[model samples]
Target: MTSDPEEQVRLQGFGEMTLRTAVATLMQLAPGERADAAIFRVRDDVRLAQSEIAELASHWGIEPAPNVRSPGLVPDQHWPDVVRGMVREAPLPSLMVAFLVGMLVARR
Candidate 1:
């Protein structure tokens, strides 16, 4: 299929930025907080990470939309150590996880 090079490039850039934004947002929310966005039309890595994040939260009893999240939609802290521990100890999604790690490292 013939594709517009410019449009495709723009879409790719948008996708990368979206992932970066999500990582940044989640880091700001709460420690070891799990956030999930729609899987439909999102990047494979994004969908996978959200699913993993949800699972990880459940495993730790970190309920989603918890009392701290107000409407309980967002994370409450970076919880970097918890996230870092999980990332180090388990096989988590790569792309989003790496972005978040980079974000955390950059912050330090």
Candidate 2:
């Protein structure tokens, strides 16, 4: 809530860095009894952060973009099914992308 624009930008940058660090730490943790708990904690934190960001944006008169989808695109409600179908249609490519993402995240 700093009035200075530079301070606000710095704070936002720091928040992003912190979130990325948390995700990187989570990725490094070995899978075990604790991993599920950690994942849930991160998920909740992310949800909270998202809500906070939305509130802040609204306060600043920044409206979110409309959810516009082109013709033939799957509806928002059917995203899960669409993703499943895509994976089913191209499992190898999906897996490769997933692997590459994991590697990139780990590198961070």
Candidate 3:
């Protein structure tokens, strides 16, 4: 299949990087409790993924995912700081693994 260049992402490398990290977060959460605080974190990552994808998709005149938050939600002081910190301080997938380990160990 031919790749569509118009659909390619070029501008926000950070978005792509964050998405890769979010995927790992999701996989790690698959077997866990929703009550665990990290599940909320995973949701945040998922929202970030959606937002980045939406921003990219919007330029193409496509209808982005419905659940994607308003741009304001992220660029704000509280959320953006944490999100950026997560991207900068740690690899998302690895963080999820550590979160799961901590939760599992704590339960024992």
TM-score leader: 2
- Between 2 and 3, whose TM-score is larger? 2
lDDT of 1 by residue, 1-108 (tens): 111112211122234333333333343455444332322224233243455434434444444333453646665566887887777876557857888999999999
Better of 1 and 3 by TM-score: 1
Q: Per-residue error at 56 for model 2, in Å?
A: 0.7
lDDT of 2: 0.43
lDDT of 1 at 107: 100
Per-residue lDDT of model 3, residues 6-90, tens digit only: 3322122123323333333333332332113121122233223444433433443444123434666654579878877876899
Checking candidate 2 for backbone clashes, the offending pairs are none
TM-score of each: 0.22, 0.26, 0.20
lDDT of each: 0.43, 0.43, 0.40
Q: Cα lDDT for residue 102, model 3?
A: 88
Tens-digit lDDT track for model 2 on 1-108? 211212212122124333333333333334341134221122233232434443444555555444445655744558888878877888697789988999999999
Q: Order the candidates by TM-score, highest first.
A: 2, 1, 3
Q: Lowest summed-lDDT stretch of 10 residues in model 1?
A: 1-10
Report the backbone clash tally of model 1: 11
Model 3's TM-score against the true structure = 0.20
